[model samples]
Target: MPRILITGGCGFIGSSLASELLCLGYQVTVIDNLSRRGSELNLSRLLAMGAEFHKSDTCDPEALDKLNDSFSCLIECSAEPSVLSGAVGDGARSLLNVNLMGAVNSFEWARRRSVPVIFFSSSRVYPYDRLNACHYRETETRFEFVDGCSGVTQAGVSVSMPLDGVRSLYGASKLSAELILREYALQYGLPAIINRCGVVAGPWQMAREDQGVFTFWAARHYFRLPLQYIGFGGNGHQVRDLLHIQDLVDLVVRQVAALRDRPSDFRGDIYNAGGSIRSSLSLREATEICRRLTGHEVSTASRIEARPSDVIWYVTDNGPTGKVFGWEPKRSAEVVLQDIVAWIKDNASLLKEILV
Candidate 1:
């Protein structure tokens, strides 16, 4: 059995991945800080399924030291992506410390053990500097990328795009960590895979302003909470290709399994993991879906300014990932939405526990 360690195993993607691993009969070990509100519930769910749990932060050097040689694979999903870039140098330091430095620490520990490491990166690593420079077409209810080959296919953004001048602090930190992972694979021959995941939504997400917009909206609608649209045009038509957590786990497991069969160097390499054009949806569409599914009134207040470094239309192409890993997302947008709504409805009583 593969002894796997998930660095942020208590969080959204990490917890979902751990649950899948347990179902597949893998011996899973999780290390997490348990700082996030709902992470404890995620951890408890995994523990109920018989996974080994450790309460520790992956950013700590001593904690990394203790994790040495104890697992066959390491999944690094622990990082802060929500801290606003405008919060002075202190916020910048926190992003670097958790997102970049934490990756270095985890990679070093995995390198020492010669174990494969998978890094959960973000789509923000792209060139946000080019966002407002491009024009988008408002077809029907959603926006589409309107330049070059990306327009015709609606296949969404590919990995070949440039990353220069992406001034967003979150993007920069994630890109820096990606570079560190690549260098470790190149310089030290450490095995690593970088997965730039699209908008990840599932039951585990606690719906904060900085992450999990879909779940956030659903929660807000269910509870009649306030929502402010702070990005793009006053019309909440900014598009994103949201992916379900289950699809993400399938990709991670397949990539890790492939590496075990033919361990090769993947230095500085990256892949975009997402649902592609078919799964792309705008906030307008999301709100309507929420209203229809939950039978609740959805309200939106518009703001003049968008979030810093917010991409106008960030979806995945998935061509390279499909070609390389023989994987494609299996669920549709309606399927994901229906499932999430059903999950929320069925577990209404447990929402407090899930939200922690």
Candidate 2:
């Protein structure tokens, strides 16, 4: 059996990946720094499932060295969780250290041994500001992509879109890592794949005021915490296409399989792995769904200031990714929301850490 190592394996996406890979008969090793509450919980679940765990930060070479690198592949998932926090300048250093340098460490270590690697990238790397020219329509409660941006066949945002000046500090940091991954693949003959995912949501996300919108909303709705619509503009119609953890893992697995046979095809590149246009939803719609599902009202306060460089509607085109991995999102927003609500309602105590 081929061995695999996952950095930040205790994260929402990472944990889901670990579980899925274990079921597929691979020797899985999870490395997490345990920086977030959700991550620790994920690690606990993985440990219960008999997956090996190393409580170490990926940015630290000493911690990474502890792993038996005889492994065939590595997935870098560890990073500072909040893009907003990183945007605020206070969290810039942490973002650089964990998000950028952490990936550097993983790639460097993997390159030295000729191990193939996969990286988790965010859609924020796209020139979100340039998307302002795209059109959108507002509904009774939320917004939807207008024009050619709707339906499953709509071919969401492609990788070729210019990534010039449209990212927050968090996005910039991830973009830096993506470039480095590409460079390393070119220089060292190490096969590398960068998956640019959007709003990856499932169980085990650390819901907070600053990040993980879906999980945060679930927690607030479950515990009746204060939910606020802080000046995002429109009827709270900022739409985000969400990708389920399962679909994302499937894409990664496919990439791994393809690389195993033909490494060159998988190296030196980036792909947008997202939920496509049909899966996109707005804050207003999400709030209404939460209210209808839980029989609780979602909080909404008109914003005094609109969020910065925010796009009213943007959807990722997965054409290239589908061609590469033959993968697409399988879960509907309703199904994902149902699962999210069920998990948080069942694990109510997790909200305490979430609010903090």
Candidate 3:
């Protein structure tokens, strides 16, 4: 059995991946700061599931250097995962430290140990301004791209889209890290793979306004909390695609196996991974689904002011990813929401303290 080390393994995506890998008989070790809300709960769960836990911060190179255990692979999941992260005073500095400097530390560790790395990047690396400027028409429930749009496809925004505009500071950090990974792969022959993921949601997510929108919406509806549509004239029509955590883990397992089995065949460095156009939902559509599932009638309001880096429509095109990995998201939006609802209900006592 291979040993896997996951950074930020106490968070939602990291913990979920650790749980699945452990269940599949891999030796999983997790290192996390447990700084985020609800991370302690996730950490406890992972510990109970037999994953070794280390309370450490990735931003500190000294801390990373002190680790003694050897692992076959590293999954870089530690991030400040919010588009609005660097909009305020100290946020910019913090974002750079965690997202950029942290990657450097991970890459350095991988280089020294001669191990492969699986990086969890975000679709936010795509320029926010350019995505907001996409040509689209509004329908009854959501926005649709105009016919013959240059950068978009039936599958959604492709990997070939322009990256010249302003992606938020968070995005810039991630993109910088990606470039560094590429250089390391070329110069040092480091086996690095990047997954540019979008809107990954499921249970165990401590959802917030700027990240994890799906879980945030579901939790708000279930708790009868106020909901709002804040951008694009506040019609609740902004769109995003969803990918379940299980589906993401499935792809990661396949990629990790291939990396160990046939390293030469996994040539593609970066692949856009998400549910694509088929599993996308607008805010309005998501609201209705959440309302139906939660049986709650939460009052909602609209504000015409748009948030910084907010995109009106974003559904990732998984074509390139599927072509390379032979993997695509299997969970539908409804099924994903249903799963979240069940998880929330099952753990209402714990979630209420954090979610509400």
Candidate 4:
């Protein structure tokens, strides 16, 4: 089996991928700064499971240079990841240093070592203004996107969605990284794959106000915490496609194999990935599911003032990726929610330390 290196591997997605790859008999090493909430716990899990760990921040290029080692592949999972991050003055530079510059170092390292790179971008790169402009019909339960919108596709928001407008600081950073990755692929012949993923939730997401919507929703309900619907007239009509981490890991395994055996055929281009239409859900719909799973209804407040960068509806069109990889997400919205419920119950004591 090929050895794998995952930067930011102690986070939810990276840790999950590392565990999966390790179980499949691959040697794995992870690097993390452990700066975020729940990272320490994630690190512990990875360490106990036999994944090697190194403490380093990607913001420092010198530190990254030290880890420019021989590995079959490098999965770039380090990013602020919050669409709401860097919206204010305090977070702007920090977000750029981590998301943009960190990515630069990752690309440079892969170029030097001739390692395959898998970059995790985000659907947040699509502008919120355009997403909101999509024509929609509102049922009593949720807001549904209609077909009048130019960029919108039947499967959901297509990869062809408008990019001429502002997509927030976080989006700009990720998109900037994607553009740079293209350069590395073309110039250095780096085996690169960019996955512009949507909301990925499952067992170990350190859900917060800025990211991890579904996991946070489930945790709030499980802990009897107060919840709020803050946008689109507070009807809880905002919808997004939800991808499970397991499905993403499944794809990564394939990408790694392609990069190792057939690097020339793997284009360093963008691939949009999410649960697609089959696994999308509205906030109201998610609330009902949580209620059923937790058997407890928590108080939820509704605010009409929408937050900056909040979109009404944004699901992914997996058509392009399906044509290439013949892969579609098998996890439904119900299974995604149910898994969170099970995780929360199983780790209620530890979660309360960080969540409550």
Clashing pairs in 1: 182-268
Worst-scoring 10-residue span by lDDT in model 3: 259-268
Query: Which model is ahead, 2 or 4, in terms of lDDT?
Result: 4
Query: Cα lDDT of model 3 overall?
Result: 0.87
Instruction: Assess candidate 4 and give its TM-score to the true structure.
Output: 0.98
lDDT of 4 by residue, 293-336 (tens): 99989888999999888899889887588677667789999899
Q: How much is the lDDT of residue 164 in candidate 3?
A: 91
lDDT of each: 0.79, 0.77, 0.87, 0.88
Comparing 2 and 3 on TM-score, the stronger one: 3
Model 2 alpha-carbon drift over 4 Å, by segment: 144-155
Query: lDDT-based ranking, best first?
Result: 4, 3, 1, 2
94-150, model 1: which lDDT tens digit per residue?
678888888889888888888888898887777766654677788767777777432
Candidate 1 residue runs with Cα over 4 Å from true position: 83-89, 148-153, 352-356
Better of 2 and 3 by lDDT: 3
Error of 2 at 174 (Å): 0.7
Reference-based TM-score, model 2: 0.93
- Number of residue pairs clashing in candidate 2, backbone atoms closer than 3 angstroms, sequence gap of 3 or more or interchain: 5
